[model samples]
Target: MAVAAGCVVATLTADPSWAVQRPDPRPAAQPAQLSAPARPSNSDLEVVRLDPDPAPPGGTTTVHAFVANLGPETTASPFTITVVLPKGVTAQGPFFPTDCADLGDGHVVRCTFGPGLKEGRSATALVPVLLSPDLQLGTLTGGSVSVFSPDDRNERNNRQSFDIRVVETAAG
Candidate 1:
């Protein structure tokens, strides 16, 4: 190329800045890890509460505990549920919503839920529990069901348990 006197001519080259910036042909930022996700809320996984705080004895009753995924994205991963046995309260059988293992020796019931728990959604297992026929009518404390999750942002709300009371079955 020839430039006239007092005229300036610049050669063009393939430069990154000169290239068409069509919305950054790449993700804003790809996550490095696949297991745990970075979520905006502190509660990525949580176990909200347990139903039937006072369970009746001598009969099989359905008990449900709420597990929540408060993250920004839905995830497909199995989480563990552990129900700490209350004195005189024993599980009649394995929990419903299937695919659960009863760790008989531990006296603690464990259940696995979901390959995917949607964000802001809650799930639970309707566990069948039977109060011991001979259980003295009283409150059993420290009995809780907790959810152990992989990418839970906060661990505070992962467990919920209340005093379990064994009452006489109503004659109906």
Candidate 2:
């Protein structure tokens, strides 16, 4: 401290007329020039589609979907996956004991199940869909599956869709 003070005193004495002390000048930092962002390669964000289970005429198919956090982002909560019942099929009971229901699109149903989606985590749900007795004994096709991010409250994300197909049921 004494040596620093002595240095300051010597500097001030050398420039006695100066009222205020001046600090050494430093180089100013230039504003950073940001480069344009790279365009997406069409290879990013691949969404793994889900498929619905197939049911046969006069039979019941319990569809269990494997839901997973298949993204790099950490979901604050588990994602809600709704299985909308397709045509010729009927929902048996309450979807999940909560804010979800069967919209009964004949081939589509919506369900919301929970907690949250952590990275690399997965969950599953059972969908009991009863096929109509009148369905032809051939391969019944055209089914859909989907998942959303509604936190057990609302379903604002409906753009996501999954593909599902059902083959004909065999004779009992």
Q: Which candidate should be chosen as best, given lDDT against the real structure?
A: 1
lDDT of 2 by residue, 30-147 (tens): 5543453322121111123455555556777765555555445545443556565556767665444445566655355556554435556665556667778887655544444556
Find the candidate with the highest TM-score and give its number.
1
Task: Give the clash count for each candidate.
Answer: 1, 17
> All candidates' TM-scores?
0.68, 0.50
Worst 10-residue lDDT window for candidate 1 reads: 34-43
Please report, in order, the local distance difference test score of every candidate based on alpha carbons. Answer: 0.68, 0.51
Worst 10 residues of 2 by lDDT: 38-47
Write the residue-wise lDDT of candidate 1 on 1-172 in tens digits.
Answer: 4445567665544665567566766666556655555443333777776556465556555567668788776754567778776776666565676766567743477888755677878888766777777777777676788988665767888888856767766778
- Candidate 1 segments exceeding 4 Å error: 1-43, 53-55
lDDT of 1 at 7: 72
lDDT measured at residue 133 in model 2 versus the true structure, 0 to 100:
80
In candidate 1, the residue pairs with backbone N, CA or C atoms under 3 Å apart (3 or more residues apart, or in different chains) clash, namely 76-115
lDDT of 2: 0.51
